[model samples]
Target chain A: MIPLIQAAIVAVFLGTWQMLSPALGLQFFFATPLAVFQSLWALMKSGLLFYHAGITSLEAVAGFLLGGTLGMGIGILLGRHQLLAKVLAPFLTAIYSLPKAALAPLFILWFGIGIDMKIFLAGSIVFFLVFLNTFHGVREVSHEQIAILRLMKANERHLLTKVIIPSAIVWVFAGLRLSVPYALIGAILGEIIAANRGLGFLISSAAGRFDTAGTFAALIAIMFLALVLNRAITFAEGRLMPWRAAEEGREVPI
Target chain B: MPGPTAPPSRKSSEALPLIEFRNVGKTFARGALEAVRDVNLSVAPGEFLTLVGPSGCGKSTLLNMTAGLFLPTTGEVRYAGAVVADINVRVGYMTQVDHLLPWRTLAGNIAVPLEIAGRPKREIAAEVERLMTLVGLTGFGASYPSQLSGGMRKRAALARLFAYDPETLLMDEPFAALDAQMRLVLQVELKRLCRLLGKTVLFVTHDVDEAVALGDRCIVFTSRPGRVRQAITVDLPGDRDLRVLRYDPAYLAQCGALWRLLTPPVEPAVAPQGRRE
Candidate 1:
């Protein structure tokens, strides 16, 4: 029943947009749903959609993994080491607050408008989100839990793996979930600035030609990609922390 | 009717003191708050000693010092004839909160200590099962801490504490968070386990009845800047059921005595009528 309502909502929205396009002179700017579908069909047949979408997906995933790993590592390190964290805190905050789009052109200059540039831009954006969450997560772990493990003769490795990492996992996942869209945005922004391929290039190249339908097709593809990635993350979190799911399950019935 | 008191164990008194506090005092926040002061006490091996005091009177501080979580501000805490300067891994500490890893199942949480010791898979599994049964959590081994009741979680913590088989247990009101009926049940279970394992326990509580019911010797502390007011030997038989023991005349007398010891002295200026509010 919920799925039916959701599907009906989408149908009605598209139907209204398609019907009102000609009356409102929106066809040239927003494009009709039929026109956008036609544009998508054309791109699919020519395999341009797959080629560009593949490049964009690769950039986003690569950026997300590299950035997420580095963020988690640095966050854990800084969280554990007070002196190092204190010294580097100001610089990290400054970098974190900077508009990521402003860094795209600079990244392009550094990495020469290649896949490296897009990856670096997306990765840098992802790094801070994951890093901030993971750092706080590590810091916020119950000191009582740490003490318990210590008294149980837990060495540093055991504490990290068993207590610290597990305790901070929820925050890490929060960061990961939050950064997925930002990762795509960073990749697309880099491609818009200087790339010859990727979904961002498709959108920019279409807009340059005033092809509203083509631009909309690329955007719809990007939205779908974001949805898939977010779903994948949610799945991984559930797999990794089954106990957390059980906890929530216990709460709902009451 | 038996006498109100007998005597503390001669066996424990004869044994070498496993934990000793020499002129121990602790002040936190750069001497802004004094938690305990000029405390000198010792726990003999295999003795179940309870520290009874008002809240913020530094009962927990004494246990923390024994665990080597922090050092005393003025003096020292010694365990097994050596000054404890680091985390003492030989003692198991349980506080009011269970502190179970939320992501781990009961079996997994209980297996923590054994895992830390690098026990093999089969052994850890066997030990975890034994502990689960010991704590009456037999079939609930697969359950997470969040799935359990307050009493059940406490049992899981008790199982986890016993998994490593530490020689001494430092419990800071471990069952204080439970309901009255559950608290009594756990108290009996804890006493039984402590006796069965021959563990030397330093249990802290504000409950006068609890202090009298559990300990071989109960040490009463004055309210804040907690100093030992008296150390009373409970002298009760170890095997008595806690429910029956609660109504025993001797037990009631001990509890009454501990209550009086814990009551703060009235100030001269404060009117007696004003104290009611």
Candidate 2:
């Protein structure tokens, strides 16, 4: 009930601002909040909201999977082979240093104004983040534990499956949390640059036609999408790492 | 009788020590320092040896050589009269660090070796349950290491080693993190388990009481660039429990002497000539 009242207050304040915008001559640029909500309601009624949202969500999910898998694989590999990681460290850093947005034009040249461009762009951004995190996670695994396993005559496969991967998964989940928003941003940026569909395209096209309310509506939809994706990943992380929550109070005596 | 006992061994006490360190010298920091030097030692199969020392005395380094985790810089460590070259498979080890994989359930961590050894799924499950029960973790099979007490995690570590049932055990300060009562409980369990299994053990600790309570013989060590100071036989009665031996006059006397051996000698206070009465 408190939350609902707080929200109501925010809504009323915004509504008053919207009412005063025309009188204050701020309606042209400010995009009255009521107008934005009404436009969003219209898009929902017409089913256009889900259409653009579906396209953007699909692209983001595809990119996330592509980048996350490849990142994890190479991350674990590079993490396992320190020499290889050292050799490639500078080159990887140079590439990662450039803003992922700078790759937009190049991605467009290769994949054209389709989902492919956005997917690749998103995948690349997500990949580097996950890779770096997984690498650090693998390296941070206790050398003592590895020594203990070795004394048991544990082979490399045993070490990898039993210890290394499980430890690294914690970082992978962290990467997932950080990468989800970036994943959406990547997908939307590609659409904004050239795509015919997606929330980004909807917002760009609306802005071009001076429909500021429509632009606000699309932005709000994108925010909702990012929130949902982030929530899903958070759920997965909790399920995958049940031990972590228990660790803080780990030593309760019997 | 309530705990898992050691399997019967036909080898007699007169048989050669299963593990021997001959003139073993281990140098660390690129040979800047010798952690241990000319350490000559042997443990007959099924004999329990406790090594006690102050910090930085290389007691753990000595145990590591026997486990083949560290190769002696100057001399070789032998197992059953043969020099161990690589990580030795014949020994089960528990170190001071937390080794229980947090991701695995208690049962899963305990069954790691069996899985590595290619044991079948059904048998692995059964064996894990058995080991858990042996370590008094009967209902904790599904719990992760993070959910357990410090002592409980030690039990899980102990169970993991026992699952492999190696001929020898090398433990380095395994219960050093626990409170006094917990340490005693775990130490008693280790003693009971070692005696019943007839497993040869090279255990390392700084606590003299623990060394006396669990060891057949306690080896005292000197400070850095360590070497054996002296070896003291515990002489606690056979067929006895650690709790009983902990308070026994014989045990306390041995612990006292070993503590003296471990501590640096105190220099006599000198009186100033000007202040002489």
* DockQ for the candidates, in order: 0.75, 0.52
Q: Considering only chain B, report the TM-score of each candidate against the true chain B.
A: 0.86, 0.85
**Candidate 1 displacement at residue B260 in angstroms:** 5.0
Tell me the tens digit of each residue's lDDT in model 1 across A4-107.
Answer: 99999999999999999988987899899999999999999999999999999999999999999999999999998889999999999999999989987778
Candidate 1 lDDT at A17 equals 95
Give me the candidate number with maximum DockQ: 1
Quote each prediction's TM-score: 0.88, 0.87
Per-chain TM-score, chain A, candidate 1: 0.97
Q: Candidate 2: lDDT of B85? A: 85
Q: What's the DockQ of model 2? A: 0.52
Which prediction has the highest lDDT against the true structure?
1
Off by over 4 Å in 2: A1-9, A12-16, A248-254, B1-17, B27-34, B81-85, B175-198, B236-277
lDDT of 1: 0.88
Clashing pairs in 2: B6-B196, B6-B197
Cα shift from native, residue B86, model 1 (Å): 2.6
Q: Please provide, for model 2 over A1-254, each residue's C-alpha lDDT reduced to its tens digit, 9 standing for 90 to 100.
A: 99999999998998888888888998777789988999999999999999999999999999999999999899999999999999999999999999999999998899988899999999999999899889988998887788788767789998998889889999988887889999998999999999889999999999999998899999999999999999899788779777776776566555
Residue range B1-277, candidate 2, lDDT tens digits: 4434543222334567788888999998899987998888877777888898767878889877888776899888999889998788889888776588888888888988888888999999999988787667899988888777777898789888888878789898887767777667767777767778777888888778888877777888766667776787777764557766756887778878876665552223532223233
CAPRI verdict (incorrect, acceptable, medium, high) for model 2: medium
